[model samples]
Target: MTPNPATEPRRFLEHLYNAAVRRALPLHNTAAFLPPPPKGRTIVLGAGKAGGSMAQAVEALWPADAPLEGLVVTRYHHIPPRPERLKSRIEIVEAAHPVPDAAGLAAAQRILAMAHGLTKDDLVLCLISGGGSALLTLPAEGLTLEDKQQINKQLLNSGANISEMNCVRKHLSRIKGGRLAAACAPAKVVTLTISDVPGDDPSIIASGPTVPDATSCAEAIAILQRYGIAVPGAIMSLLEQGALETPKPGDEIFTGHEVHMIATPQQSLEAAAQEARAAGIEAYILSDEMEGESREVGKVHAALARAAAHRGQPFAKPCVILSGGETTVTIRKQPEGTPRGRGGRAGEFCLGLAQALQGQGGVWALAADTDGIDGVEDNAGAFVAPETLSRALSLGMKIDKYLDRNDAYGYFRQLDDLVITGPTHTNVNDFRAMLVL
Candidate 1:
């Protein structure tokens, strides 16, 4: 069979994304960080997009004779298939993500309950990653699951960064922000984390369920106020009185606990860079801790790519630019009776990139969430070609109209450019690559 040369760049972009994801998989990165078999049982409690995979990794590596059992919660459809001849000891459950639900609330309550009755000889293995905040939902005192879900949805569309969102989540949650760690005290907790947040701050990843939090309820209140999210009087009273403050550094509960960041955005980016270099393509990696609105970041990347392609001042031709990090999108209010927009950070980025490129030749780009879903949409992300804008215009698709409505998914779906990889079962946040030839 002959391969089409015209699609080579697009193929390479997908290859690069796969390489980045491979580097962050728990099977590849978790063994070395595994702790010694505990004198008592090893209770694995976790929640996130990667929870199922991380549990499988632990099951694959741990001694078969050791006592291993517990439950982990992951997003719906995120549980990977068990390998042939691979027996299961730990239980994996699925729940809603990016928003709290009744299932998540039940799972969180069960996980916290399991933490009780632990002895000093027991080992509590916490597998944490991105999306854990929503998957492991346990509303604080006086707050209902519905309240948490509404607040979560608001914060997601409020343009707040991950840290700010997590802060609020920690303050409002019964299990997050070191409360889980506190619950498992005397059991010697060990957290194996896949970092999906900027700076790999343990406190922000999964709202730091098994780690101490430095943020206070006051700070969370301030963030909510800054974003114009109205807090109920009951929750407001708790925040103002500092009754919901998270466990801080030097807390007695974390005396012997340990946290190991097994995978991170920077490491994944480096892995992709290595693969690009092996293919004889010069690669440059921007920071892995970038944070901002998705469209603006896309414009900045477009400018850099254009400068490299046109001027050749910063970078030479035939090169690839890579980056990783989480970005936010402020959902704009639509006109009454208008349809809601569909898409996530990656799609929005492509919208801005395609508009700014203006059909510039010799450049192609792909932006995707490593877990293979952008926002709640079914696409990992989308592709941007030199003729992206022109093709859309020819199809009667207005780039500005979609951008205004935050409808990158709708715009890209019409052009058949959406990248759908389903669930990879692991998340290192967003992956972006631009190929300039």
Candidate 2:
């Protein structure tokens, strides 16, 4: 039975979110993408928010007698609990994300070392998903880990899109942008990935570590210059000299390489739509590729919801509107001695949504990151309801102030509306559902 959205909107939205996540679980989607055991050993090397679960899926599927061993690096605390009887084969390690740390650097170096000495008969299965660009960090020549970290922070804060951020990442890293594929020269490299970006381009997913790169060093430099992000002088020289260029498409090293998108934001959004339909509620998918500033996207969604609620235009009553994609957040500068705002794209989205909703009747919504973390915060995201503004007013809270500071986390936490699902072990990026009755 479907929970009534009028009184149980949170539960209903949570159900839809869970359905979406279940559809993208690595175990549910990895089977067909798995290649046959190679003539030589099958070595798995991977990095992402979903790395732990993807590694576990491989361990569960491959024939017990087959030679399958590898290492995968996942976000800190992201490894799911192993099934009671499942034996561990892949060495799964934890590392920081959205920012690289020493552990991630070490893991990247180790993964690169492991790719060495492979023959043509061997198979290299790379399980990639969102967040790999940050998790698999190996600095380029003359660049230090600290330099990469600062650059990553600058790019992230500059509101650069995933592709742009990754373009810069690929040029500055030793293992990304097809360099990883080049390292495994004689082996057949297969990458099984979950798409989180808007277009599902393999080259942009995790910065295409195992696939050929079509992006150029000049493009990377242009992106950096566009965003006003800087690199070390020597690294800048390499960029100018084209010495930081990734292996381009048609490169001989990627001859036998294959990439398969096992899960994607569209699939997850469709799953949510199906779940809503199964519950006898009409569901409309806006788009799986929605992007732009988080707050602006939220305002647009509010307009649609308001239209549907007021005049039954575009969508009728009792409908759920769904969308999925990685939204960007541009952190606002705060005055000195003032506390920095805390929130991710999901939270900022909700804040804008609530402010624009203006306490319109009969609307409720949820916005969350599929990986269960929002911009380094513990909360996946937050919720919005018709009374959101009124409730805040009652608590002497002003919506515009929070929005000014980009403090959605603080705003939602006061309302006890933050969604706190921890590490779903898979990512197809953002999952949002708006219920208009």
Candidate 3:
């Protein structure tokens, strides 16, 4: 039975965001599948926005008889209020993200050191998540932190996908590409992660410090050059000579390494679907691995929404559409020649969708990074109600112009549509939903 259109829209959007957060929480879905407690000691080490929450979940689930203790790094303000006893077992340290800092480097080094002096009887429980790549930064022998900072800025502006960015990171870091797990000889490494990137390739997340890397050093060099990013001559020479080899699939270092994806964008989208159903609406998930230019993705979703609104071809009216995954934005110009824009993939996506939407009636949407901060900006993402563009016009602001410069955060903030959730203390990539009624 067709119900009221007014109430359906708001409830649909709420279900979508709630679904994203639900999937992020580390609830054990499968008890038997969890790794067994170690005979020796269990050392937990990880880096990412979700590190704190992941650690807490581990402590709550793991048997008390086992010796579980270690350290992890999360973005600033990502650490959750921990249970008193769990805090003593797992040390959560906050650090800079989307950019490396001294604290991150120090934490990376300490994690590597912890991997040392391990035996076959011991176990290393690595809790890796989406932002781990940024949270863990250990430069190669010749490269300085400044060099990494510069290259990172270039990549951010390049609009390269996470895979390409991670490829370069793996070769230049000592901790990544299964080096950490390799350090703990004979000790079994069990890595549990919440996959933020589509495809959930373990090696790409945090550059796969505890997992074998399929990407070669040559590929890394190619990525840098393909994106026109400059690297130090010494670094280039090393890559050219194939001296910086990351662990590959066949390497014995990962013999006993086991990785489990505890949560993912797809799961989050599903949660949203359940919420939609409860609200007397039908929900259809487009895809969990959507990728490409942020604007282009927005255009695609816009087309779908338009169809659903006017013709209801692919989907009928009173239905909510959802999708998840990371998207890239290529900055055409940087005024100071310093990359571009402050907002992240999520914010950009909303801008693209909003502009394409053209303030259509009865269609409300929301886009945000599940981890809270979108890109480097202060907001999780933004909201697009029926009057989104109309509201912007009331303030005499042009959102299209902002989109042209990759400045969605700036555009939305003016109208106060930016969704600021601060650091969600977790990341599952971007979550987007559009309700058509």
Candidate 4:
């Protein structure tokens, strides 16, 4: 008999999540996007949560006789366990994510240096993914690493969307916004990336290090000002003068460059839906380009789940609702004596969902980042059941208070509901599932 989602909701949900992740694995999606070995040496350069896996895929598939060498940097502990028999050809280093660190800065510099002297006959294979913006950090002239880190923190807490944030990042970086591609002038550059941003715009992924940037310095300046995030005075002057502009579309340097999206949020969501269907559950994908405040989105999802459960208006019984895309959480200020809340977008969504659900029967939900890490926290996300609100109440936990402080991590931990999955060596942004039976 098929397992019932009502009886084992968490297990069923996790199975679907795993299926989604497996669909985006580099080993499964990289082969088709791989270019034939060039006449000259093939140099690989990459940075992201999936850098290690992407490198391994190339190493395994490329002709063992052809020359292959370069560097890739991934978030610390994100490298997948190497197959014992597989020989490593690319250098995979570890660094920080969501925030740039000294290690990342060094890695970006090295990756840039590798492209400095490529010939027309050489091929540059760039393995980029979602976290590349933070992992590959080469600051612009006159800017310190400290400046980038501080601005990054402000952007994260500013509730700025991915596009807006990346726009700003492209202007401040020495290697992003098509600068990497510009460096490989006269050489063939092939970029194989996994899409984590909504709409899967190649330029927006990892700040489009290898793709021509359509965003301009003026736009970046406007985004920074709109968010009230200040920058160093010199950088602001450069932006105003258009001295920090990135390579735009139609730039000659990008001639013959190719970008292939190996995996994407929509594909992963479809994979999850297929898994649910195979298990005898009807699944509906709400969207793969969702954005906005995490808590508000959760409330909207709650409304949908309640409607399906009570009236079956939009979707009938025994069905799963799914969504993908990155969401933002604007950190709320705390009183001087109080500690700040800890949690990412996924956790915040759950808190809002649980509160809005009001203990509605026969409803369960799971929200997580496909990369297996939510924000900067250890947990990927969190889960919610019908009794979530009531259980918290029993433990002297008030959902409203937690929501006020954006304390989804604390709230979920108290209920033993936080989803903890170590780095899955891939990223396609957020994954959410709601089961209404």
Q: Candidate 1 lDDT (Cα, whole model)?
A: 0.93
Question: What TM-score do all the candidates reach, one by one?
Answer: 0.98, 0.99, 0.95, 0.99
Instruction: Write model 4 residue lDDT over 1-437, tens digit each, in one string.
Output: 33568689998898888989999999999888888899898999999999999999998898888999999999999999999888899999999999999999999999999999999999999999989999999999989999999999999999999999999999999999999999987899999999999999999999999998988888998899999998999999999999999998999999899999999999999999998998889999999999999999999999999999999969998899999988899999889988778899999999989989999999999999999999989999999999998899999999988888888999999999999999999999999999999
Q: Write the per-residue lDDT of candidate 3 for residues 1-437, one digit (tens) a residue.
A: 33343765544565568667866776543243468887798899998988988888877888877788899998888888877765358888988888888889889988888989989999888889887776788899999888988888898789788999999988988888888888877899888888888888888777788888888888998899899999999999999998988888988878967888888888889988887777777999999899999888988999899899999879998888999888998886746765455677888888889889898877888888898888888888888887888888888888877887788888888878888777776678889999888
lDDT of 3: 0.83
Clashing pairs in 2: none
Judged by lDDT against the true structure, how good is candidate 2?
0.93
Query: Considering lDDT, which of the candidate structures 2 and 4 is the better prediction for this target?
Result: 4
Query: Which 10 consecutive positions of candidate 3 have the poorest summed lDDT?
Result: 1-10
Model 4 ranges with Cα > 4 A deviation: 1-3
Q: Model 4: C-alpha RMSD to truth?
A: 0.9
Model 1 clash pairs are none
As a TM-score, model 3 comes out at 0.95
Worst 10 residues of 4 by lDDT: 1-10
In candidate 1, position 411 carries an lDDT of 95
Which candidate ranks first by lDDT, i.e. highest? 4
